[model samples]
Target chain A: MSTPKKILVHVDGTERSITAAQYAICLASFYHADLTALYVINTRAMEDLLKARIFLKDEQMEYEHDMEADAERYLNYVDELAVKKGLSITKKSSRGSVHKEIIDLVKADDIDLLVIGELSRIRSRRDEFYDEAERAMRTVPCSVLVVKDEDKVWEMYESLV
Target chain B: MSLIDLVVEDIVKIPMTSNDKPDVLRELVQTLKDAGQIDDFDAVLQAVQEREDKLSTGLENGIAVPHGKTAAVTRLKLAIGIAPNGIDFDAMDKNPSKLFFLLVAPPDQSGPHVEALAEIAKLGQSRAFCKALVNADDAKEVVDLMKGE
Candidate 1:
């Protein structure tokens, strides 16, 4: 296989996912590759939250606004990091199941590499969400890099922290 | 290192009053400094802020693991803090953060660092475990819960 020219990073705004983004940015910088950072919102979870909003309609709106603001903050952070590192990057935000969104983005953007944070190695059948993400990995067309907690790459980011 | 390698003591504060991410981090860093677990509190704060400039540490389920690897630390350590008021760590869930696991590791240990992060991610995803952390009133309670007691 040839070297990947573009990378798609899956960031959930979690510490782990953000860390994964950091790594992707660094790699992009090294390879002089283009990067697309994506945030996937679980629509099902949002629907559930909306369904439970019996007592406070305003509160739910406030909650959603807050979430969007947070996502923006995180995306901006990544943008700044890329700028500082001299890496080219594009950011995208979507609301849907994480796996499907990631797959779609891969096909739409011609992404050569897909990066994601590892959830857990030990998951029961009850961990349906992670199970779905893991299953999606099998069908993804590009090279996949799962940033596990046990990987040494985190130390590189840790140094900058 | 395993998440089990990290220990929580009497530092967990249930019902923390701060509702913002900066304030929560401020409080937690201060607590660690006061407890003498860390020296040069300002350095740690700067490191965290610099890291936050790159990305948020907020995870799912109202948990934020704000961490940094710094030269000020001699070894890897973990501090657990709980805020019942749910500080905004800018979690992906858009939910306010109630539990914080502040990680500090030396700049040299590369492999253990990632393992430590992975361990935290594993623990953070466990709803039951996070609930136990939110309910913890003191450091020992937090430690015991992380220990799966």
Candidate 2:
């Protein structure tokens, strides 16, 4: 494929996803493409928790609030990395099925490439979450780059800490 | 902020002698204390140990990022230990972990804490970088290797 014109990376507050973001940044830099870092809050999981009555109403609200905070922190980190690279990225977050939100965003933004971490390699807290992650990977509209490199994708980004 | 900023000349210990996970952790925590990064070494050490008790932060590729956030530190601090002999960190890969990055952060500063941990995790992926890190003659070389990135 010719150089991608747009790239979207999915981050889920995991180390592997951060690595994937670094990979996406490298590709964006190489192709001079527009880049975005997307974080999906996995509200489905939260809903399931509610259905299971695992947490009380106030507890669920507190949990959701914490998750939102985590999403903001991570997305900001990606933004910081982008700024250090002399690049800017659109930071977007959604609350719903992680994969569905990502796929929808991909179509909406006309992304040419979707950069994501190797989901299977990194263990998700829930087994069903892994299934959702796979489904999103399989259904994305554009080319999908599952970043699995055990090497530094961008030296300069890492140095930025 | 970069990990380099959190590290000083004494924050890194090459050729760590502790053979077990707990001892190695203690040794590294002591290193941080000696660097004047933390005041209550015992409290910080316990926090790290408790984190490890939850789940080993040991990743694949012989790297482990053991981290904790506590009031012991006013800001984010890092201590690196390279055990050439490889300590049994109970890593996911079932391999001995040689590169150790111990991160201590204040409870309020989650951003820098996570950033430092993620940076080390990404750095763990580079074979050449890890190889060079292990081969570096002194703490300065290790710092240079990280800063040279």
Two-chain DockQ for each candidate model: 0.04, 0.03
User: What does each candidate score in C-alpha RMSD?
Assistant: 11.4, 12.3
Model 1 regions more than 4 Å off: A52-56, A127-139, A149-151, A154-161, B1-149
- Please give the distance, in angstroms, between residue A77's alpha carbon in candidate 2 and its true position after superposition: 20
Winning model by DockQ: 1
lDDT of 1 at A65: 57
In the range A17-131, model 2's lDDT, one tens digit per residue, is 7888988887787789999999876666556544433224654565567667878898999988888888899999998877799999999999989988765543323222234
DockQ result, candidate 2: 0.03
Give Cα-based local distance difference scores for all models.
0.67, 0.75
Q: What docking class should model 2 receive?
A: incorrect
| Clash count in backbone of candidate 1 | 11
lDDT tens readout by residue for model 1, B40-121: 8888888677666556777678888777668887766676778866777887678888888787765543223434554566
List runs of model 2 lying over 4 Å from the truth. Answer: A1-161
Model 2 misses residue B105 by how many Å? 1.1
